[model samples]
Target: MTQTLEHEEVRIHRGPRSGLPLIVAVHSRALGPAVGGCRMRRYDGWRAGLADALRLSEAMTYKCAVSGLDFGGGKSVIVLDRNAPVTPELRAAALTDMGEFIASFDGTYRAGPDVGTSPADMVVLRRSTPHVYCLPEEHGGTGDSGAPTATGVLAALRAGARHVFGSASFAGRTVVVSGFGSVGSRVAAGLAADGARVLVSDVDGGRRDAARRSGYGWVEPADALGTAADILVPAAVGGVLTPETAARLAVRLVVGPANNQLSDDTVADTLAARGIVWVPDFVASAGGVVHTLGRESEGLDHGAAVRRVEGIGDTVRLLLKGAENPLREAKALVGRRLPPG
Candidate 1:
């Protein structure tokens, strides 16, 4: 793949202690020092992990910009062998090495938890640098950001509901939540509590039982994208909405907390052609960043931080109702906040 050199800085290092590839892409520092999550996951190669880091970091730039955050965007990826055993000892070694790599940036970049990492891992990263967020509440950080993120998604969903269905209520609606993990599970529960018949799906079969136990229907991951429903919350991985799937998506609205939800920009056009209200993922997924930065970095109170997250609904409402193209309107919002290139 021909990679674009649009980012301000990019670095790849092989961890000396863990013998793993540690990739960090600083997409921009125009607003301020970059802030994004550190993701540890299996990848075919270090190059593939770097690709993901590049894409995610750019998305974080838009995410922060649209949310009115002062920070720019950056992301770190620790590539794991596809079939290698991730023993605790090895995990610690990789995390420790990553911490040291992050420390090299001084205060220019900060990291939080994402995907395979957790707040506990942020604790590990903090040992080498203070530029980590979302540490356990006991450790003085705001802790897991899932609830705040889910809250923001619900707010956006309500705005989207009003845009598409002429009401802001989830009542009597059939909703499908893809990916029953931290953020996804909370989104599912919130929708179910709002009187929406929620169906959940996960790539992990173990989550199926948990979904059912929560009084939600379970769909296999293979059948999730095509499952008919009023809305589809893609709380899982990216690339779920492609030209192929967008052609057959059975939902009227597509919104969630996933990053880089579209395979490419063209997919958004396809969704529009299909009359689907696809809220831009960068706009929909800024809650975690907003809450974490507000509480930990900006010294906002808990209630105030939550209020900022809830403001996402207003942002989405403005984007959906104020323009003919919400995606373009959203990018305009980001562009207005971002420094000139």
Candidate 2:
């Protein structure tokens, strides 16, 4: 099936240097120049990668709009064959190819780190274009965005606590954090520090020992959705909050740093029907971009950047408390910020 694009522009280029297929989707330019991360992942096919680029880019539109970032939404994807192993030589070449692709956009689109890409990869990307962001701090850019992202998640979680539990603390609460990666580890640690009983899950069995060392219970990935807890933090991939998962969710509140958490817009209604306070992923996950743009683009000091990231709690509070339907209110907020065509 051919994927239809409602975006401002979508381009697929066969990398002249690496022979990899690179996709860049610019979903909107209503507010300003488009900005999003470069996601390099192994896909069954380039079409699947293109679909991800389309969906993630559109989510970034709402992410930026709702977070009050001036930038619009865009994303770049490097599609790798699922069966092929990525050699260091091949990885370097792909970054160069991605850089070249972003360079072609001039400044209309900028690339940052996401998923498989990193600040080191951004350094390699700088070899081709200046539109790359979150380069290592020593290179005049903020380093890994995971910390700020976790900070924002915790902030949102606190607000969710207040809205759902009538308290602002996670003390005596049981929070399930799915995906024990960089951001998930940090969120789990924060929850533990706040006296919450944190259960961590990851598809990677290697992380089990680390979760145990942190005094967190380990739940198998398959059981995470149905595990009873006060909250569920999905810090991994998108599309985890589908209708089927929402039906069995044992948590009172759902929020995390995962982008495109809902499989579709209708999942929001399904969650509402289930009585789950599902904070929009864009709102909860904006801290990384918020902090990066604050420090790099806005010339904010470190303290200012940190403070701005913490403001996500306030945003979540307003969204949850102001209306009967938070997702509807959030979409309305995004609609207001976006200029009419």
Candidate 3:
């Protein structure tokens, strides 16, 4: 069975030999072309993969809208087989075919990097399609967007700090980052640099080792959510802040780059009722999209992109202080730019 949302288009593509299940969901294009990252994961089934694509694409629309970008939101999910051996040739064949499939959109949808994908993979994608972004600097594209993404998250964290603790500095505050990937590592490093007691956790031992090397404290992934912290940043996966986990959270603020952090809409009310200030993931994680759009569409230099990302702090502060429901406020902000349904 195929599923989709209103004002959305879902396309399923299959590779010849690799049998890659590529699901692309274009959630909206009311503003401009749809843009989002390409995610690769081993899902339980096609239904779960499609659901993820639809949800992430819709979230991208809100993220772009809240970030003041002119593009709409879309996402591509490549479902991998857990038992299959991922040889180099198989990977290349799959990506090449996926690139061709993306190129068929003719810029209506653009794909970058997400979970299990990278700038290097974007390079592979460019081998077949010109519709890719976030390539290496030598390739004349914006490099990893994680830096600016982390930058924006840090800015929003400070804004949340001020809103909750009456100070903007991270000095003397305890922060737990639940992911140590490209974005999470940068956030942890930034917090450590700013004198925050940064603790990091990841399922990967290598990432935990890296966090230790960077002088940040380490927590096991199992204990990350329940760890004592002034701020809890779920930077890795989504649906982590479920009602059960939210009930046990030991933090005053929830701010991170994880998309769809809440398991469901009701979790927002759960967090709020628990007195935990929740910064909308779209608002907190928009720096990457903002940087990518600024550089790719607006011809912005690195410094200009950084400056634009810094504005995320102001936006978060405004939303937190002025709106009773920040997520609804963000959606309304996007709705104003979109044509009426």
Candidate 4:
């Protein structure tokens, strides 16, 4: 194990056999045990993975705080080899190693699934750690948070629409959803069902095909960001809205489930200056955490959790209408609740 501690707590672990490199960052323990997902992906380098872990862990803290969860922020990133095929054996070995690493944290950190990870992987993780969540429904855990997450995004989108266009209804509105993955696909479908002119795009051919089969207008990945629409949703990955991209955005509102949506913090101000209403990603994308809290905490079931998640719309509305800077306001909301070290 080789660990580099930032102002926030962080741990780096290497798999004994698979040589898997993992970074765990615990941003806070003020409210309770740190809670976040474990993201497995190929990074440019170990340092890049470490940076991602740090950024995501801090976001997790704010996410929990904004969602009214009694948990701090933390995240784990498993670095993979891009050149190597991630076979079943490789995935199992890597997850097993990660589970053991998580177990060492005791109860201070709880792990769940993120990008490139799934409920099935959580089952494997549960073999080594009792703190794993989002396991298979048969295992008494929430199977997948995609539905709830989409619900939250939908709610937030409506709220943003109301704030920006003075209407909450999506009827006749064009919603360009970039990245038709698990959560993005749900979001796009929900918008379409609600009578929105939904346009979809994804880097993967299969995802684009899925969008087409679902009757959504397919936009190429290259033009998705520049599409003229009522709302531009970057649901794929982070840093898509850099200062340059924000300057060129044609939408009135920018809202999506992608974490760290702003390439740089200043991009929020830039968007604001350009007359674009930017809903903070943490507030809009907190449905999964709400679901997790309901499952992990006492007296809250999935239905109740979903109802709680719906409150995100109201939260976003309040923040957008009141706060001068929604991002800073969201962070302040968490900072006020955080306990002193």
Candidate 5:
């Protein structure tokens, strides 16, 4: 069956010169402004890119809402090739384009960086637009959001392990972190730092080697998830947790920073039947939201934002004990409330 949008609004703009300008689906008018980071990914076509932007934006909307933040969700996708950011000039051009594209919406839907984008990259985009939020300290922004994102993910993973395997420590437990990107790399480091034996895997050999040097075990991408680890964290691409991979899982709990970690709701049910306590993707992987959370630059008083996300433990525990999954409960709590920030 085709998918239907329960919450969100989508907008598309194709630049006359080249590249497609996309504002993914945004959810909630309750939030003053819909805030999100922009991502430049390798897409087969504009249509595919559009779908990705729309879906991610919607997920982000609920992510912020459930975290109890007032910001709505929005995203931008710069479609080109896998090697989109080749040189300084190329990267600069992309950010410049983003500034122009996103400026159209003003603050209605804000965009940052994702996938191949970085905090430094956001600075370039900021030059063209003052609307940017996550910047380096030099640019009057905190440099590393990866750390906060990783912290939130790690906390959620611990919560999942406790609720599922009835264990609180990861002394002897093994965890495989796939796709060690910006967030994933930090997550791997954080987990290892937490005394968990972490096996790092990424599409980029350089990054994988770096992780290995950081005291993490290394494995090929496919081999990473197949191990008999107590926990399996997918920090890789979306849709990797389909039936085939889902069935191959030998871990007790799953938590990671990948978007749409499951292919769909079916993956959740499959894991449920197999007795694998699968943490909801949107709920477990809310680190990016925490890192990106802000209202005033001088110092963002997130209040309970970090606690709220780490507290996803409570929600996960409730889902484990209740009839519906954590995502359902989160969906209900968020309640289409993306009021302006």
Candidate 6:
């Protein structure tokens, strides 16, 4: 937390034919390879895209390190106009840009997917560079890591439940989930399947209806926290849990896959004081990153990857067990691994 901007790197990438979109590199820590996802977005502009990528990548480093993963954090953002057509040529160029950028960093950074991206994109990325991971295997794919990420978030939620209610089981318990995107949708589904009565919300009415038809309880997006649930999972976006909003939060646990979930450590302390068990974002949301890593050109087959990720339950348990300070312990794990200098 004390570190400044001394080590971060921001770079612009270009291809021969046009459209290289900006790629920002934020090397927050270097315990190991800088690992993060490539998020393609309709950024406001080049500057905005770069800033988002830099901050996100840096956060990933802290998240991974805190979660005991030996990966330094780095994030990539592809600036694109929202209206940009996903023409085959444009898509190919995007993948090529990824390759060019990865070629620059080499071992220092590993790439995965984030918002506005998917395993399918990874396949395209493989066209330009073999650095892609988490593809669907048939296209010589490695598969999507979204499910594993949801699983990790589920584990953290279970741990948080114990801290709040003395049990991790959500049977008959009420829970609300906001966002309903890739991570959020899976989280809601997982919670409901585990016996938690779920209240779901999303800006997209179609997604909301889909959840309801899928048997998930439904509610307006604004009504999530007011649903009188045992847990509130905000899987939507960062800064959603601000001081004012958090003060109004009436839930026993807050665990989700959203990065920067709390905005700041003050929120962490606030949650603790309110008797709301907050599983740190980095710890809870790392399944996807780790899962992506499992599919790396470094070889861990599907079965092996599944076993390794499911085994993360132990790490989550340890972090939650009589926690002296889950955050501190996780951070210490990172500090210990970094060499003396």
Task: Report the lDDT of model 4 for residue 311.
Answer: 96
The list of candidate 5 runs beyond 4 A from truth reads 1-8, 16-24, 81-90, 294-298, 301-309, 336-341
lDDT of 4 by residue, 107-195 (tens): 79999999989999999889998998888888888888989999999999999989888888889999999988888999988888889
Each candidate structure's TM-score, on Cα atoms with residue i matched to residue i, is 0.97, 0.98, 0.96, 0.95, 0.87, 0.88
- Order by TM-score, highest first: 2, 1, 3, 4, 6, 5
Model 1 pairs whose backbones collide: none
lDDT value for model 3: 0.88
Q: Which stretches of candidate 2 lie over 4 Å from their true place?
A: 1-5
The C-alpha RMSD of each candidate to the native structure, in angstroms, is 1.6, 1.6, 1.9, 2.5, 3.5, 2.9
Poorest stretch of ten by lDDT in candidate 5: 294-303
Candidate 2 local lDDT, 1-341, one digit each (tens): 99755799999999887789999999999998899999999999999999999999999999999999999999999999999988998888889888988999998999999989999899999988999899998998998999999999999999999999999899999999999998999999999998999999999999999999999999999999999999999998899988899999999999899999998889899888878899999999999999998998999998999999999999999899856667898988899999876
For model 6, what is the error of residue 19's alpha carbon versus the real structure, in angstroms, after optimal superposition?
A: 3.6
Error of 3 at 339 (Å): 2.5
Cα lDDT tens digits for candidate 1, 1-341: 89758999999999998999999899999999999999999999899999999999999999999999989999999999988899998899999999999999998989999988999999999999999999999998899999999989999999999999999889999999999988999999888888999999998999988988999998889999999999999999998889999999999999999899899988888888888999999998888999999999889998999999999999999998856667889999999988787
Question: How does each model score on lDDT?
Answer: 0.93, 0.93, 0.88, 0.87, 0.72, 0.74
Model 4 CA lDDT for position 232: 87
By TM-score, the better pick of 1 and 3 is 1
Per-residue lDDT tens digits for candidate 3, residues 255-309, read: 9999999888888888888888899999999999999889888999889999999
Give the per-residue Cα lDDT of candidate 2 at 102: 92
RMSD, candidate 1, Å: 1.6
Alpha-carbon error at 292 in model 1, in Å?
Answer: 0.5
